[model samples]
Target: MFNRRKFIKTGAASASLLLLDKQSFAEILPRQKTGKEQFPIVISTWDFGVYANKEAWKTLSKGGRALDAIEAGARVPEELDITNGTVGRTGTPDRDGHVTLDSCIMDEFGNCGSVAAMENIAHPISVARMVMERTPHVMLVGEGATQFAVEQGMKKEKLLTPKAEKAWKEWLKTAKYSPVMNVENGTNRPGGKYNHDTIGMLAIDAKGNISGGCTTSGMAFKMHGRVGDSPIIGAGLYVDNEVGGATSTGVGEEVIRNVGSFLVVELMRQGLSPEEACKEAVMRIIKKKPENAEKVQVGFLAINKKGEYGAYAIQKGFSYAVCNAEKQDLLISGKSYY
Candidate 1:
């Protein structure tokens, strides 16, 4: 005969036990539903750097990667005629009124590429991408970079615009007689110390991938061919998925002198918070030789996957633009790019 009653009792007990086990497992496992899934992207500009426009953030939100976002955001200043120091149409011109541009890109893989003191290209960062994808070299410069741009089918055009010419003429008329003005002197005021030639971008994708890029019209009034830090790998842009992504803006010489981007990433790898790393790097510049060095203005911005974002500067005021899945805000912090 079938023992229906016993079998039913046993099955019920087993079902209850299984339910309890599942409940226990659920309690033991972490509840990550509230955790951050996708990474956030950040883009910033110091005092004179613009971030109010959300056009760039919109592209990233629409699924554009960091590289796309970087070029898009950078081209804003290039086309709007902002910052006369480095790679745009309005960048300060040399005594001859010729404008040169500098740019660099760092990929998620940590491979970096750049172009320095390049002329005639409106979008130097795009050309830098060509260098990265086409050639095995890390950098290219001047006429060579221009030639490469042409060979890559980049449109060629007059390097100088009317605005750049006006800026150069204005600078010449106000020129003062000083050793700083003498061509024979090492420092011919290529770009005024206060002049800035760089803009930086750091971005983190929804997948936690990070990349950085920097673009600039080379220093205003440079020695016709002087290159600054905008195109230097570690000085301008750096990305290490193990740490974070970093970009620097302001005086390229000072940024390069401090090895700005790499120093910040290394600091983060040593367990320093991104903010601490940025602050430390800027503070180091403040402590450089000759006691109070020329106010070397530099701005740094970074973000780790933890949603922890950081920025610091050697100047009196610095501002950065940030866009997460939620919103976009230009975080204006501190006083300057010291």
Candidate 2:
């Protein structure tokens, strides 16, 4: 009762079905998108980015430039006195109890500026923009950056808030300095939950121009004068109007070693989706230091010229905010490697 022809036909049909199933499964993965073009979209790292995106949308929805939108977005967290001790003036201080800030801004024309280890400035993002607009340099650091900020008419104030001071006092009791993974998103520390850290934002304007900005307080209780990737172009943030923009959060050292954000944007240029590109960037970090990847968290958020966006992280609890015409105040949990 063996019919070779019938058996072969059935086998072919089964194989076709299996292939179709595989394709279907792939389509449902987090990396897959419809590839539709979205204009005037803003995306930023962390749930706090929800507020930041809303601020950016004010300019973006009004047909403003991507550069302006991102600057406006980044300033929201810089002025907030949140508990995360991540962004802005109230951030957790360095080991010696100095609250230094780092920030960078990039425009659609490849012009960028940054300030690192700068103290006493409440809005470092604005200072960074001034550096891009007024200076011949790409970065300013330490006392020089503080002087520049003051020269530009920004006031110097004590950035350490009462809450931050309390936390620092508590941390000094233990004096244990270890980077905690996912500390930003509801991670319980000795004092309380650290809400978030490091806000990196990217926006696409109605004219299809792309711009990005990154601002951070650096790591909590870090060494004095330590400047993380946030203030380094092509490390914490990169934007190409013709390609896209990418930003990163978490451990800046890991991000800096791999030029994390630039790699994500470049991967998108090579025809990968934003999510796929972000995943590849994270994998590169893991491949370089698999052991460290397990201990610390690093996440990348990217958007393509088409306005399609995606994100990947080394650990869970990394999230981002997205705002567009269709969706506003949306918080998306990033896909993680772990």
Candidate 3:
């Protein structure tokens, strides 16, 4: 009763069917030719990105690598003295009044590194790069991240500035916490035009390589150990040299739920323009949570390998900065769902 010949044929047919099912779900579109390529360009989230873009252009204009340029750009915001509690050491503290930071970096070769819920280190982005280049890990968090920074010769400083502490004391009076939409546009800040959440930058260098970086202090008055999407690859940031790069701002939770940046790049790979891809990603979030989408803000900025860029958001007031050889501080308002 053991028919070996028939069993072999049936097993081979079943294996072929399984393979076909896998391919159907994972089919990638062919890379299509887009418009003219713009070499040595940089783009970033928020109006503050203008300053960051200027810094990045310093390297990009000179034909530097995109990875170096984006890191330089990201540092500009981290080193700013007046970031309005949005990024770097001056960022608004967690509910417990501690300043924790998150950051991530991705290079052209698909290499990425991240640090989340880190403290005392001024530049988490640099530590992220060190993680990507030195260690075999993609992420480090909390005390371990801080220890690595110290061992690498980065000094530990009191990140809680007088102004930030004063604000924390004020917030403690009420302690009622809810994320304000468009906080980066100065919607809910007490008295500052620079109040914002995150800075995410993407670049394309002369050699046509793409890289991206995202850094944030996370939501104002978030849970003490809360880590948002800023340091999570494919959520807050993603870069594929062959396809393109994308970075996100606004509510990190919504972005993470949708794997926002990676979705944008994959949509681009499917032959959608950067703007179209960004819009598609935004719509997915809105569709999944129509009620919640009304209260939160989420935005995505994307650039393809051909140098075309665009952005979309869940609410209005989202804007991004662009820097190329022709213009250094160009700002564009992103199209929104609501």
Winning model by TM-score? 2
| Tens-place lDDT digits, model 3, residues 53-72 | 88899999999999999899
Off by over 4 Å in 3: 1-37, 187-196
**Candidate 2: where are CA atoms >4 Å away?**
1-34, 187-196
lDDT of all the models against the reference?
0.62, 0.82, 0.81
Question: For model 3, which pairs clash?
Answer: none
Candidate 2 TM-score, C-alpha based: 0.88
Best by lDDT: 2
Q: What's model 3's TM-score?
A: 0.87
Considering lDDT, where higher is better, how would the candidates rank from best to worst?
2, 3, 1
Worst 10 residues of 1 by lDDT: 6-15
**lDDT tens digits by residue: candidate 2, 1-338:** 21112111000100111112212211112332457757989999876677788889999999999999999988887885353468886688887888899999999999999999999999999999999999999999999999999999999999988877787888788988886666665434222323225999999999999999999888888889999999999999999989999999998999999999999999999999999999999989888887566677899999999888999988776778788897776667789877
Error of 2 at 286 (Å): 0.8
Writing each residue's lDDT as its tens digit, candidate 1 over 1-338 gives 21112111000100111112212211211111223335545555532233412445666677777666777767665655333334465565665666778888887787777887787878888888888889999899989999999999988787666655655676788763221211111122223432444567777666667777888775556677767777888887788887877777666677788899899888888887777888888878766742433333566776655556677766443455555565444334443332
lDDT of 2 at 36: 72
lDDT of 2 at 214: 98
For model 2, name the residue pairs that clash: none
Off by over 4 Å in 1: 1-38, 47-53, 81-87, 174-195, 335-338
Report the alpha-carbon TM-score of model 1 versus the true structure: 0.77
Going through the candidates in the order shown, the clash numbers are: 19, 0, 0
For candidate 2, the lDDT comes to 0.82
Each prediction's TM-score versus the true structure: 0.77, 0.88, 0.87
